[model samples]
Target: STNLSLSIDDKFIQSIREELTDLQRRLLTFSIYDKQTSIKDLSKESALFLWFQLFKDIIFQLPKSEESKYEMIEQCRQYYHGNQEELTNIEKFAQTYTEQDSIHWYTKQCFISRLCNKALRTQDIELLYIFRYYIQDLHKRLSLEHQSFRNTELNPPILTLYRGLKLTHDDITHFQSNIDSLVLMNGFFFTTRNYDLELESALKLSKHSVNILPTLLIIQVNVQLDHVIFAKISSQINNSNEDEILFDIDCAFKIHEVYFNNKKNVWIITMSLTNENRLIAGKYIETNKREIEQG
Candidate 1:
């Protein structure tokens, strides 16, 4: 492993050095050094002391005591071993996981630590996917639990950086206000099945005053329209074979899935509308799988 001598908690570092089973230690080390996944690459990249030194900067920030240190190491071990089990039923997992603050903290550290390691060693999109999966999962879970727009504090800082770097069209609207709907079509609903042109159309349309925006991600079919000042969001259907999930707009249109089962329907009815501001928000609800178009 690259020995960057990144500062970390001494006691916590010591526990990682001492308490972890040989296999667990090796797995942790490999996660940091190999820049990718697989038992073969892990074995090849595994380094004991060097890996510990590289994370020194971060580990040192935690409380330093024999007991506290061991506790944190055990937490790390639990995280590495627990994630597969945790993600099985995303809704169930998120509901249970977020209730416990420690799990949330552990989850946050686990990804950042892995990302930091990957940044120093590899150049592959797989790591990026790994990062994205975690983020999307977390976002969905958080939204489900809260059932409202995410507060500024809870938004993942890393995702903000990811958007800034990628410069995707959605990135532009992410920070903007007064925009209500965004549609991104990817398959079966795109014009020529090209998402790029469709995205361009939406971005261009952003110049107009659309109270509620739509982002479509279907293939070859991309479109945008201004919606009524007051609207509610729900999903007549809940599940999808793929990661994508659909939501309903007042039983009229299917939108994208933004939350998990733990949350109720994200129905944002027109609570109030004004010349300067239009607010559409609602309680979270569960959904099923079906398609309906309102006339």
Candidate 2:
């Protein structure tokens, strides 16, 4: 019997050791192990191997210095000035892995999130749009699988990208139509400062009857608005001056009371808003149920 073999030169091994980060090296090692241990697993492992290399090439090529950081920011700002062909090629490359089923859904979401963060940090609108397309596809797939709630978790970063790009009204409405109401509301929580839109999203969720989170989000947003802004919105609801009054003041107060009664833990609300705004501006309205009972 004869066996075929190949050898990797020491120079090549040394080059890889110098070039690859620890994470990349570990992924490569796993790929090799998967290939040798189970032939059937080779496809997925190989895909991951390629994906990691591409990830490094695209994401990790930048140096880890402040100067490099500024350069990356500037590069992202001027991405439009780059060769169109090159940008299109990069977008196409990302699309390939994004459409593949070899990676786990959570892993894919995490990878896309990283790409989104980088895109935002660098103001790379082209890459951001590419990421948004992938996320929209993911949301569709997840909706079919009845994992739409989990899909909601994947939306905030994409929404941030939209805000960064200053997407048109049609673009925003198109996206809102494709996603679940909870996701739309959650996205609004992070991406929009408009009190009317926030209230509208919350009201839409309230119709579903199980959407306590949106109600809590509404309360959070209401508490955060500047006193003057809040007063104007309150006045609109009170005087029926708004074109569409989703809920009157008493109705809104009732919903807030229900939320406080059901969710006694203040930390839940605080934790939910942790990543939402740097300054969590919501004042928690204290429930007077205990006082009423004592009386």
Candidate 3:
């Protein structure tokens, strides 16, 4: 519950109350006050309401109505989902606003960045995918904007402030760092059931840093092992019959247990590196015992 403890400034809250619709405000209130209201329960409209309210203090203009605001939100959602028609509509919408003076343009970028963070925090993989599309879109926009500014030789303080308020290279890097941290944390919670998703997350994390290879390799080995064996080993570890497992780049093997034919079995899983980058591993040791004593 750090989410429960999250507090907004009174001024910001007041501004949100003024700008958000009655239902939107209620959703925000319930999300903050009611501990049982999960983020997933909120509809897309509610999510967009929160997204807009997050930047109420900085945004200079407001959408004319809840319906119009929701339209904007839907456009973003559709664009992220790869709707070609919506993408064209969104591009047209972006062109309607002047890059330096347009609150609409700036808000769109903030919306994407904040939504990505929200998706990551809530562990919504589907939402994360949608946010990623917009993240890439925002990245391209920033790059082009930077190049345009250099070409036009317009480096005014106001334009610089506008760029600072919108997405930047540092902002994208920070967003990606949050993603890497989430992937690494998710890898630790991997089980046989979610092996594919966990492996995908681990692979994405590996692209960010080589140091994660050992951790990824460990999770991969755990994922590839038989579920029955893993279950029994996990149970033994939980029961303290086996010591807690430790993971490292150089640590070669781990010993654990499994059950077969109503008998106790022991297993040793070993790991090694082919080079600085590649990992190889194997399992050995299988001994059944009528009565295996606990540690």
Best by lDDT: 3
Model 1 residue 186 lDDT score = 12
Q: By TM-score, who's the top model here?
A: 2
**Candidate 1 runs further than 4 Å off:** 1-108, 111-113, 116-123, 130-132, 149-295
lDDT tens readout by residue for model 2, 1-295: 1232224465677555443321221110111112132323334533443333233234323333444333433443355356574455445444443433311222222333334445544435466444444433333343333232234334342111001122223433333333211111111012233444544444443343331333323233232222111111212122233322111100111011122223422111111111111111121111234445678
Full-model lDDT for every candidate: 0.26, 0.29, 0.29
Q: Which ranking of candidates, highest lDDT first?
A: 3, 2, 1
Residue 37 error, candidate 1, Å: 39
Query: lDDT by residue for model 3 over 158-186, one digit each (tens)?
Result: 11000001112332333333321111111
Candidate number with the higher lDDT (1 or 2): 2
Higher-TM-score candidate among 1 and 3? 3
- Residue pairs whose backbone atoms clash in candidate 2: none
Worst 10 residues of 3 by lDDT: 157-166
